[model samples]
Target: MRLRSRLRGEFPRGWCHSAQWWITGIRDLTLNTTAAVATVVFVGEAKRALRHRDEPRTLARLSGTFEGYVASLLVNSGGLAVLVTMAIEEGLPVVLTALLAGWYLPNIAISATVFVVVARSRTRQPAAWAELDFVDQHAPKYGRPPETIEEYRAQQLRE
Candidate 1:
């Protein structure tokens, strides 16, 4: 009939005290943990994309950017409802910690897929650093046809 009596038997007598202390620590950390993790992942991905933008595989960088954005958006948004449900079933302190961890953890995984694809492409791509320089030479100079694209390809292929 009494909640306290029922909870006492259902859980150990000292569980409430320990859980309360743990929840207090969780509450202190919830928002900070979420923001720090999400920020680190986003910034790291952005940095990688920027640093590798000049890589031969243009499509890889483009797709990585798009995929990371969409995945993080979907996971974080979808996890909001789960967070709310958890808050109701559990408590905010506990649920928020779990929510932050579970939500962004998968985001890292999803982004890794993009990174791996790009990395593999890098490994397979032929070493041709002058590809862009060849394209640059095509710019008309003083009304003269600077060079043909086929000629540029032939040059790089010869190297």
Candidate 2:
């Protein structure tokens, strides 16, 4: 019957047709917004670390990794919830495949972006550290390495 087909997600179920709207909307509200906020904050902190020339890049990288994991977990779980809801409404065999794919694919792509940023930052940074060390050694008037940035600043002031 048409009812069975629609219930099983075999055909298009527009807005208000099935629980699809509710499920997707819920995830958008709960998981997506939170992920976006966390991503922004993490990125800002990473930029701050770079600006300050701090060695806490490792912490920033790990935090980025955690953010990616949280995003993946929430997106996949929300997608699965929607899929299960659809399957329950209709039938498992006919659950809309596009909905299933749509749910997690974007999150996977976003996670990959997070991964690439972390990796590239690590690669670019190691070389930059040598430059930092070089400056630390040569730019100090006495040709001595300062133990900390604060010490370096004090030496520069005296010079």
Candidate 3:
């Protein structure tokens, strides 16, 4: 199938001849890449935070850091913000634009405060198997658990 057809019929016939189509395609591609990067960072941060769940302050700081990362990514990358702005420019429905803005504005506020919230946080350390078991509650379907933090770190790094 053609790329134009795969885009949910948003680009009508002969759209390639129009500047709007090029602009929209570029915007979509950029935002999609940004969102994918944000998702990876979010997942990594979540896993790191889970390992440190026993430490309340550390967990909070890690969680806050990830949240800030997401908010900053969104505001800086202009994914949903671009959508709302485009909707307004195209004279789309007020309710639709308002809904998009509702999601966007809070991230603007959040991105502004991320640095203040998580300034001096530390990085992740390997937790014990007992702690991991308590958190995961699932047995490994492979070989034995790591004997030391170094070994566990090596295993995780391999993964």
Q: Evaluate all candidate structures by whole-model CA lDDT and list the values in order.
A: 0.49, 0.50, 0.48
Ranking of all candidate structures by their lDDT, best first:
2, 1, 3
Task: Return the lDDT, model 3, position 114.
Answer: 41
What's the lDDT for residue 41 in model 1?
46
The lowest-lDDT stretch of 10 consecutive residues in candidate 3 is: 133-142
Candidate 3: lDDT of 111?
A: 44
Clashing pairs in 2: 7-90, 8-90, 8-91
Q: Write the per-residue lDDT of candidate 2 for residues 93-112, one digit (tens) a residue.
A: 75366666564555544544
Best by TM-score: 3
Predicted candidate 1 versus true structure: per-residue lDDT over 1-159, tens digit per residue: 268533433343455466654574465465334433353444555456656644654534242244345445455656666776777887779756776767655665545544564555555664543453343333322223224555446445434
- Writing each residue's lDDT as its tens digit, candidate 3 over 1-159 gives 357323424544566676766786676565445433343434444455546545544554343334445556565558675876788688878887777666555545444344333332323333432344332222211243554444465466445
Model 2, global lDDT: 0.50
Clashing pairs in 3: none
